[model samples]
Target: MSTPAAAAVSSADGVAWDLADLYAGPADPQLDADIARAGERATEFRNRYEGRVAELDAPAMRDALAELEDLSQLADRPLIFAHLLHAADSSDPANGALVARTAEANSQVRAGLLFFELEWLALPDDHTEPIITDPAAGRFAHFLRKGLAFRPHVLDRPVEEALEQKSNTGSRAFKRLFDEITSGLECDVELPSGPQRLNESATLALLHDHDREVRRAAARALTVTLRSNSKVLTYIFNVLLQDHNVDDQLRSRGHPMQARNLANEISQESVDALIDACAGANGMVQRYYRLKTRLLGLEKLYDYDRYAPLEQQDGRWSWDRCRQMVTDSYAAFDPRAGEVVEMFFEHSWIDAELRNGKRGGAFSAGGPADAHPYILCNYTDRARDVMTVAHELGHGIHQYLARDVGYLQSHTPLTMAETASVFGEMIVFYRLLEGSRDAGERLSLLAGKIEDSFATVFRQIVLTQFERAAHAARRSEGELSTERIGELWMDANAPMHGDVVELTPDYESWWSYIPHFIHTPFYTYAYSFGHLLVLALYATYRRQGPDFVPGYLEMLRRGGSASPRDLVAPLGVDLDDPRLWQRGLALIGDMIDEAEALAAGRD
Candidate 1:
């Protein structure tokens, strides 16, 4: 049942990003000068419009918004630089200090300008509607309208200002500590060559090794390290949970996910429908895993075995091959997407090297709209890593195109944010699938795609469910023990696998390392939302042929100028329909069916 292990591909070993576009380095003198200039702008903004926000006419409101947008982007540059540096190497004290300084500085600037939002929030619907509809409001119209949703939740200017200023040393500091601790973890995994110490990314990467025992070793090593740091990690979790709860209570929000729902510009009912639909489709998940178990030739599948390759070959992808394939796939879709993707590779905007102290996982950071987005990923040369590159580049493409929307409106909500990335991944995925040389290779590709979909659609729901349970536990049961949280994690995960996959005891602690739970609570569901949305959209593309390209591209270009519903409406899709989500599940079912048919052909 074992596949042959291939030699590791080191093609990406020297692929480091050049960040000089952002700054010369962390110690660049201009970093402070930019911060100071942003600070001065904030003070001036506050002095100019502190008490006059509610009384401003449409033209005056438009001018204030433009000024705010300009200052906001200026303030964001240094903090973005600090964050990117710290992510590249959190172990460096200077990088860590820079993050702290920049964050505190940004917090002070936000505090100084807090009254603008508060005053706007205090305005009545009658007073705000005219300004939102006025031609004089210009590009700020959508931004103005979006602010109305926060009217009920916003605190008074003074309290909001204090909370903003104190967050640097409070929840923000603890989140950074968690990052440092997890990023610094060194897992001592035993390899056939010898005992090798690897960082979190490398350790996680080994879970896909063709050797099952190596995967088990990597899994156990991760568990042991996580257990060793359970005390601090658990403490950090509890503190953040309480902090979030306190904030929710202060803002008079009804539930744990309400704030996130509002921020995503989605209805609570729609999110409920999404989660409910996914939960209802858990039968498809268990069925797929059962099929996976049969294909892997195992009596029962373990959690670590979930990513096992069906083919005899390890299927490693070199960085050069990955770039060519991804870019060619994008180019086949549209020349513009291909060109946008090339810009990332051409400008050295990606940091793909595997190294100690680098943060685990992958992300495409959309810096200030004036500058381009930068990507960070651990490119281990696996087939899955190729998809990761496509996914992040999808985000980079969206961020790059949306710059025309200006800084304030260019960023989409988390719900719509994943649209481009997931779509980009599908474009590459189907391209690879189309070129499959044989039934076995086709099945292998399908299996990989199905598992990835499960991870995106089903696993994210589990994470969100776990967050809900933990938040509720922290509130009702007081401080939670590590065992209690572990139990909650298991409870949330149980429905997804059912009897098909046996989740080992060690899998409980696996939840400890997820950065999203620490960085942004309730952020996990957006993955599911975006994935299902893309699945449906991809189906539309398949059906419509060449006609679908322009609408899709125009949708991305629109950015967050409109609500998520309005933004995607041009594509002739309904977000609120329960059946739309079911269609996505049906597409997943079709993938599993195709995989099963291919598996039978191999016999």
Candidate 2:
């Protein structure tokens, strides 16, 4: 196990990430210069090889792929910069405008490069296989294979370019509008103490408050604020939904979600099985919520009390304590994992301040393949916030390990993307569990981990079903009113609760705020996929003991260099096995069983 190299770890004081490594700031003149240079490079490449990528021999093919990778990195550097800036402060018009410009610039460059993929895909297997399969192709094999997978649904080059160009002003614009409205929202929750003015992050943090009244106040605050903005958000969602429908239609896809399935490199059977497995286990969601209700002394759980904490003490976790807990947890798992996480702390790669206008939720976006990835989260030091750090850092560490694979191959499908993150979180949860000697604290720890699992597994899969229903409704019934969308949500989600909890009308527009539904249709399933994938992977880690660390690390090291099935086959796991998912779900059932035993003793 790689150990954390001896060094001075710093204070966990809340800090903004220093993007000086990427650029001085948004207005840095070099940004424009880089964009201009990238544009010139794109033109040069187009002029050199526009209708001719497939004609190149093995060595030339390697060079072309290498050159294309370099060109891509250059072209998107500004866009990444803009993306990070907007994530830090979505309410800023300057950042928003920069985002649009960068998107359009990226589209133009992509349009120029479309012919390369088109020609590559156009080649017969006999013509292209030798080059793609060559040992020298290295990581590029999987990249090319993935590119070719889209051959079945690819449009003509001109049409593809047209869609790319229109996206900046069309769907992309609507997404930005959604972001601005949400980021600008300020929820006023009247507490017993007084009125608390909350940003999205703070308001969300209150949902887990030990006090039921505070949780209710926060939930309603979010509902009222979002309901006020529903008209515009509703329209934006409709346009984006129709946009996806039109894209799928023009691509001649078999259904609304085939494009995403292809993009994820997952078969429809595997995805459907995963969804069905989770849906069938909806009773488990109810069971867990029922446990939560008994623990909280409630007759039943309202949607507001879904995340309410069992502990009544002020759980204001210090940022410093969070850092120590996560770092130590990673170290306990493997020094190597800790070492990678330490690099983020030492180099200032995290953005964790809870400033107004910052994007809600959290993410870890990889920078240029050679540079470190950046993490963005609006941290409020809640216990959940620590898990959020662990989660995002999992992504960071994964990106860090996979960096050597180069940009083109460093991108994992969303299904596998959550592997490191969820595992990282589990490491921390286990560490916390192991350290807890008191039964009450242990119960709290176990319940929190279980709830997190449900959020990832059952909750996300439910969200995916909601997406499917909403898409079907929009396509068959014409435009859906906001009320109609809420109905779709209730119909899809109510069953997951299975009478274990209550769903209020507020949850209707709740779907409206989920960025995934707006930005990436069918992306929700991956969380369910990833969560269960981690549990299965963690089981292997347990059976093999420390011996499993290398296999796990090697898996991360391989990154997107191989298919998901091929990637896990070496670990003695099968992505296609129906029993694999059931085993993972069974583990969750086991946890609940133990929790019940503990609760019985407590009484």
Which numbered prediction scores highest in TM-score against the true structure?
A: 1
Return the TM-score for candidate 2, rounded to 2 decimals: 0.96
lDDT of candidate model 2 versus the reference: 0.85
Please give, for residues 1-603, the per-residue lDDT of candidate 2 as tens digits. 112111011123358898888889888999899889889999999999987887788778778889999989888889998989998888688998899888888899999899899989899889878887888776687887788888878889889899889888899888888888877778777777777677777788888888899889889988888898989989998998899888888888888879889878998888899988998998887888888889889987899998988878776777788988999999888999999888787788998877778788899998888677999877776888899999999999888888888888788888888889999998899888889988888888888889899889988988888888888999999999999999999888888898888898888878877889887889888888888888989888878889999888888887888888888888888887889899989999999998888888888
Best by lDDT: 1
TM-score of each: 0.98, 0.96
TM-score of 1: 0.98
| Pairs with steric clashes in candidate 2 | 2-335, 2-336, 3-335
**CA error at residue 172 for candidate 1, angstroms:** 0.3
How does residue 274 of candidate 1 score in lDDT? 91
